[model samples]
Target: MKFLPVGYNTQDLEKQAKNKWRWQWLSECDSKGMKWTDWLKKIDVCGVAYCTFCGKTINYKSNGKKALKLHCEDGNHQKIANVVKTNSVSSILAI
Candidate 1:
């Protein structure tokens, strides 16, 4: 299984983008309903405590490193980044 756009890398480094064959392999795995354990790796945003929207800290404490999805304000809003934790947040993120 030669994954194109592939690099022989150590654990710390990750591919920035998907190459052609790697993408195909991912799609194949998807079609077969295979769980992505070996195919992909866990990545972190690395010490990103502040939110990019409101310029504050939401006090995010994750059981495991979780991915973050950012929401922006209206067309003309503050350029400052804010990380405020609201009441709606839950423990598990839905991938």
Candidate 2:
């Protein structure tokens, strides 16, 4: 027996198209109405995003912006965001 991957299914491929990642997502505000552009960036890979704050990679594949939203709400991400904010402020003040 053989199993087909989601990419091989026509309907799944169509769904992937509908859920494709958009560069605009990085500029859009999160559910909390906070912009994450300073930490979020597009990966060269077809449907992947990178979070510089936590050094995390997010694969949107068929989930699109929902994946990004979840990443923003993740506890670890929030923790890292605070750390980044503190570090930047201290570094600036040191100058």
Candidate 3:
């Protein structure tokens, strides 16, 4: 009897590829109500939206903005936000 090689499933590979594509598409297209603030930026990885500043990830399918807001409200994110705001103000004053 001859058997196929172990761990060689074409269907699984195809499914993974399809899912990756779908996630990429969703990340590119799904950005409603997401503000482009210095404290956070939308980054999609494997179908999840993440805050670049705070390193927080959220499901794009479930209220990504809310998660971002929460992160921004956190103490660490707040500190970064304050620093960014201060720098902007300083630059504007220098100009």
Candidate 4:
């Protein structure tokens, strides 16, 4: 998927202006009934979030949950998330 930075266009700016961030989005599960709270964190900013797995901030000012879903679906994010999960499980088993 094409990655566009926040405020890349007029529409993004408008959306950013119109919407404030929701704390509940971080706790809510996606349509697939999967929660991402393990790796997703809310920053102090209004419409930005941090992904622990990818170590990147995401802008969801306009799209909200859809934006987060897309981020989670991104190839790089998925790969990192999977690797982290593997390592975590392996570490737990070793302990």
Candidate 5:
């Protein structure tokens, strides 16, 4: 039982291409036009959001439960996280 960290490099770059479908999953989300709140929970899709102190992946659950705090691994998300919490992500200005 092993779970790879959000980002790992031990895998050979070429053969590991098997998992390169992340972008395609994201593209699928784009094509569906689902709400960000809904799409964020679709599983198999992860993301990276950064600010001064946060360099970690987001944590979300089904039915819109969220605790996207910036922890030791996901630290400085105060500002950006606030923006998302306050409104639909689509309403935000491009950053």
Candidate 6:
């Protein structure tokens, strides 16, 4: 996610373009029965949203739901999600 230096109109245009793409991606997700707001609400606790599996802080404004979906599909994220799930169950059993 590189950007031009500040004070350049081109930077603003680039940002707008990226936003459009993100919005389009979100729309596609919605059509597929994936609600961006629902996903965001699940992960966006305490005003900060991050990937539970990968610990990557989300930039919702810039990347929107695409980032969340990507993280969910990532192999590392899946592995970590599984590990976290296992750990939680183990802790409950220990208790």
Winner by TM-score between candidate 3 and candidate 1: 3
Instruction: Write model 2 residue lDDT over 33-63, tens digit each, in one string.
Output: 5577867766545566688778878777778
Clashes of each: 7, 0, 0, 0, 2, 0
What are the RMSDs of all candidates, in order? Answer: 15.9, 9.1, 12.5, 8.4, 11.3, 10.5
TM-score, cand. 5 vs. native: 0.22
Model 6, residue 91: C-alpha shift (Å)? 2.2
lDDT of 5 by residue, 11-86 (tens): 3432323233122222322222332332222223332322222333443322112232213222233444454556
| Candidate 3 residue-wise lDDT at 43 | 37
> Considering every candidate listed, which one attains the maximal TM-score?
2
Say what the RMSD of model 1 is.
15.9
Give per-residue CA lDDT, model 6, range 3-88, as digits (tens).
22223233333353333222233233333343343233222121124443464655544565556676566677566555655687
What TM-score, computed on C-alpha atoms, does each candidate reach?
Answer: 0.18, 0.68, 0.41, 0.65, 0.22, 0.42
Clashes of 2: 0
- Taking all chains together, the TM-score of candidate 6 against the true structure is 0.42
Query: Candidate 3 or 6, higher lDDT?
Result: 6
Spell out the clash pairs found in candidate 5. Answer: 53-76, 54-76
Lowest-scoring 10 consecutive residues by lDDT in candidate 2?
A: 1-10
lDDT of 3 by residue, 1-95 (tens): 12223233334333423222122222231133323343333332333445555666544334434444455566776665556556877868889
User: Per TM-score, what order, best first?
Assistant: 2, 4, 6, 3, 5, 1
Off by over 4 Å in 1: 1-48, 63-67, 70-95
What lDDT score belongs to each candidate, Candidate 1 first?
A: 0.26, 0.66, 0.42, 0.66, 0.31, 0.44
Give the per-residue lDDT digits (tens) of candidate 1, residues 2-85.
222333332233222221112122232222233222233222322222332343332223311221222123221122211112
Inter-residue clash pairs, candidate 4: none
Say which prediction, candidate 2 or candidate 4, comes out ahead on TM-score: 2
